[model samples]
Target: MAKGKEARVMIILECTTCIRKSENQKSPGISRYISQKNRHNTPSRLELKKFCPYCYKHTIHVEIKK
Candidate 1:
């Protein structure tokens, strides 16, 4: 049987730049990416550089807990 917490967890990655820009500028919303990671394999939060259409550039996307 698969334990609830043992399965790969789904996380959301939001663009850091987009978040900052939203504070100063009027924008639609934050850019977020959905991904999965194994809890056992990656004990720490995952971060990736991804393209943000709203920001029109690449920015650091940090993992956010639900």
Candidate 2:
């Protein structure tokens, strides 16, 4: 059985320079979001909001790593 709630990890993502006309700007985008109510060392699903330096806006992201 699982001991506690799944772990939550935070990853930083940068926008493609070509996509946006911005100078050297790196944003902290939520690269992962998972909801594993069992795993202990694994990440869990949760609400994450991060700002994109290139896009200059906040975007929603989901867990993509396992």
Candidate 3:
């Protein structure tokens, strides 16, 4: 069975720059970050600045559906 909608959700954030690099065949794999947000408190999708090892710099990590 699926979990209830009221439960806190964990979102996946992926590096934009890393994704571009990967599509261009410059990276071995995609970089991702995981974070938890309260559904009621944060209804909108979250965007965060996080360190990407592949990018070697901080980049915008946007929330993605599971």
Candidate 4:
């Protein structure tokens, strides 16, 4: 038996708000999250509501190139 390409792929999610205001950020780094998704299920960029410690609030985390 042979297996083809993996359907589940690892993706990096970064806070949309943080990236825009990197210069104004008090923290040293921008908040990011690690997660997986099914390629066939979500062909478009994945976005989820996640908590950003730096921003101290829930923000839209969008998929970014690993």
Number of the top-ranking candidate, with lDDT as the measure: 4
Cα lDDT computed for each candidate against the true fold: 0.88, 0.41, 0.86, 0.91
Q: Write the per-residue lDDT of candidate 2 for residues 1-66, one digit (tens) a residue.
A: 874543544433333332333334544432322333324553454334655443466655433434
Model 3 lDDT per residue over 1-66, tens place: 886676588899998888787777868677798899999888998999999887788999989999
Question: Ten consecutive residues with minimal summed lDDT in candidate 4?
Answer: 20-29
lDDT of model number 1: 0.88
Error of 1 at 20 (Å): 1.0
TM-score against truth, every candidate: 0.81, 0.31, 0.80, 0.88
Q: Which of candidates 1 and 4 is the stronger one according to TM-score?
A: 4
Model 2: pairs clashing at backbone N, Cα or C within 3 Å: 33-62, 33-63, 34-44, 34-45, 35-45
Backbone clashes for every candidate come to 0, 5, 0, 0
Better of 1 and 4 by lDDT: 4
Q: What's the lDDT for residue 66 in model 4?
A: 78
Model 2: per-residue Cα lDDT at residue 52 = 49
Error of 2 at 23 (Å): 21
Best by TM-score: 4
Candidate 3, which segments miss by more than 4 Å at Cα?
1-4
